[model samples]
Target: MAAGARVMFAPCISEGLLLRVQSLLYVGVSVESIMQRHNESVEKQGGPSNCNDLLTHSYVRRQERVIRRSIYELDADVAVSINMWVENHQSHVFFDEDFSDVDPLTLGIQTEWQLQQMIRFGNHSLIASDSRFRTTKLKYPVHSLLVINEDNKVIPVAWIVAPKFESSNAHKWMRAFYNRDQTKDPAWNLAGFIVDDPLADVLTISDVFQCSVMISFWRVHHAWHKNLVKKCVDNEMRATTSRRLHQAVDNICQQRGSKRLFEDFIEDFFDESDFVDYFKATWYPRIVFVVSDSQWGNRLYQEFHKPRAGVTMRKSKKKEEPVLEDLPKEYYDDVSAFIL
Candidate 1:
């Protein structure tokens, strides 16, 4: 366009050379394709062009090699850079740089740090955390620990970008600040765990580390799954109800020679008069859904919160053990709530 035309008219640049450079500079147009097009255009005129000398694949690779760094090297470089940044900024900022506790498992590769400044800024009193695995060109699975600050912003604390997602890696990430000595580790203490099912390995965590942090299943995901199940069940019930209604009408017609009579009877049965409050009744479930929400919740609750294989000790006496306490509300809530 206008810019290209101006460049083509430059004092030292020829129109032919400008056109060749423009063709090579297109996004996603490979050097090989550019070379082929140049060769065809040159052949139509006379012979091969000199543009291939500059736009060769080897030359492109050489240029890339000058700038590119391996992901492993980049990982180490970034860690060192962060360490330097913290050292420089710690005097001015209210941040903690106590990542000296090397995880014997990770060998201090993934150390945890906290920005205490956000406590003065963020919304929630709680520390929000989530993990991301496999985030490198090498496909090396690096589990990163991120927490929300006072501004409700995510701050990366540690990166266990090890190739595996083992229990030891997770334990190492948590164990970095597992110091009982109050003098060295006064601020770094885990109050509780708010994690999904995968990270809810609370029982197994006891073997490696000995600290009681209450683990709660992520509520949003649990509610979403329940909603999905409810939708699926509702769709199935609607399909089955329609099929059954059609079959019932056909049977009535064969017996009484009138589909209208069956339709009238069905309409009257479904009609919620002052005497028949449809919302409060459970009898309609059999004619529609397989089970009511309460019935389904009760069934699921019993199955999920089934008693573990041991009795509790009460005053040196054995007692029946109970399931998980303060179960999530989604289990027992009405199906109408999960309609969305």
Candidate 2:
């Protein structure tokens, strides 16, 4: 067994050394010539006489086939089994090799009920979403959703690995978690969503649940698009433009403070047509504006523009009535930390 193991890895070691030499010195050397020289050196040193002799062996190929089969069989077995949180925490399949122009092949197994709970209950509430691809040519809309926990950290809630970014796929994901009866209790609902896109489809989840949710554009994407729109003269100018805009935003936030500057910030940075479309897509109007301090909370309350309560008018011996000023908006000591 040890001898067989040595034979299997000998070519890998030779290939590694040859690759390093080719990269550093012999840029024009072909792989075939490198292997031939390696084989001759091995034979001269009384090692394996022919490097390809073991590499091309039928037994080694058969062993590889068996190992791959074993993994597939294990994936099949795991797919058939279900336990508490088993499907939630880890991907069912270890490897998936299929690919198409639209979507990368994904080997994922999820139970319908598991997906349902994640959507309906905010089972993982603090969420981040984005699509990823392995190669530039092979595009797979693999969307990942992460849940933010009490510890102020994000964890994976689910993955929507598919060929297309169809809204139906997103709807299907929510269908698993939808329960019409649970609308009465806000605690068991979605709190917020953080995403890179304008969230045209994702915001629907908020409407269906009838929950107050905060949605924010991914900060990095905000900067990226800002730079992209500038049509700069060069890469350096593009970077400088983005940096300046970012700095300007920071200065505004720092100078005026978050609550006072919230509307100004929106108008200054995100007033483009694309930004408006994204903000208005779902039309829920609960985008979160992060404030710098507790005082800003009162400022936010003022901006909410809720009507003040009427005061009792008194008559005493026809005395002139005193005009009272509106009471200042009070801050709460224990504000709901639902979205935080």
Candidate 3:
């Protein structure tokens, strides 16, 4: 038995080294960095110096996978695991009526602490929401509801993991809060709402909360930049056109009760009737009617125009920002691809 045990253990990593690796991983050390340190330690001991011989990247990745599975049940079906978790925490977590049937599930989460924060800071204050796409391995979008705290720091009060950014999905996400039993007494009567996509979220907010809606200026600017890149031939034309359009928007937003139409302001800058018409139809109304409204204009300017540290008008920028036009072609092929 002793001889057999020795034979079995001879080719395996040392127990001490395995424990060390586990410890480092638990403290959040990167696999590559840990492997480099292991290599240095082996060299100091005058042993085989190659990390691959002892601690390969694949080995480390496997260990990471094991650790993550132990922590989060990574091997389980995502929807099943999420539903189980929600079942355990039913008081705070919420799901859509057809959660099981929905191709891409919608889940809303608010802890007791978060609910307190919302009641204290969010009531009668401007609430903001935005969605982050391709956030998880399943490529599900995370929708976040935010409010400014007493310390003047903007913090997320609730989170929604939704399938898409359509208005119907937005309605389901909003209903999670509106129908929450805990908040029924006080009710979530928001003074206003700020959202990145006015078309997707404004109507939902109006139906659910009956609040004034404001569009994030930065998101609108990014949309203009992105669309101009597609519509214009070269960078020079795009830049020139973008600058003129931004100026017109700024002037329009700054002016009180300005009757001049957005199309009229930009008509002289662009000779391309197609791009002009597209912008007019798609974006012009969103800016002029929703963002520049008298009820919300001053608040928008104060909150977004003069930017403070860590105060973003839109969702935190991802490593790769997706263009509005590219999303449908890229993601619509398999909505079920996001179901895991």
Tens-digit per-residue lDDT, 1-340, candidate 1: 9998545433343444433333233112455665576456556655433222223445444434432432114335545744554454343222233332353223223121232322221112222223333244334344434444433333443344443434445555445423321224453433222232233344444443343322222232343344434443455544444344445423422333233443443465353232123212422322223122233322221112222211111222353221122222332121111110
TM-scores, all models, native as reference: 0.30, 0.36, 0.55
Candidate 1: Cα lDDT at 66: 38
Reference-based TM-score, model 2 = 0.36
In Å, residue 7's CA in model 1 sits off its true spot by: 34
Per-residue alpha-carbon lDDT of model 2 for 1-340, expressed as tens digits?
A: 9998775655443443432332312112344554565556567767664343323233333444543443332333333422222343343322233334444344333333323334443432334454443324443355655443333333344555555433544554444334421432334544344343433353465556443333232333343555456534456645644554344334433343333333543465453545434433422133322334344343221111223211112235476432211212221111111121
The candidate with the higher TM-score, 2 or 3, is: 3
Tens-place lDDT digits, model 3, residues 100-157: 5535677777765556667766666657666643355544577777767655544566
Candidate no. 3 TM-score:
0.55
lDDT of each: 0.34, 0.38, 0.58
> Best candidate, TM-score-wise?
3
Q: Model 2, residue 340: displacement in angstroms?
A: 17
lDDT pick, better of 1 and 3:
3
What's the ranking of the predictions by TM-score, best on top? 3, 2, 1
Considering lDDT, where higher is better, how would the candidates rank from best to worst?
A: 3, 2, 1
Candidate 3, 250: how far from true, in Å?
2.4
Error of 1 at 287 (Å): 32
- Please list the residue runs of candidate 3 whose C-alpha ends up more than 4 Å from where it truly belongs after superposition: 1-82, 99-104, 133-138, 179-188, 226-236, 254-304, 309-340
- When 1 and 2 are scored with TM-score, the better candidate is 2
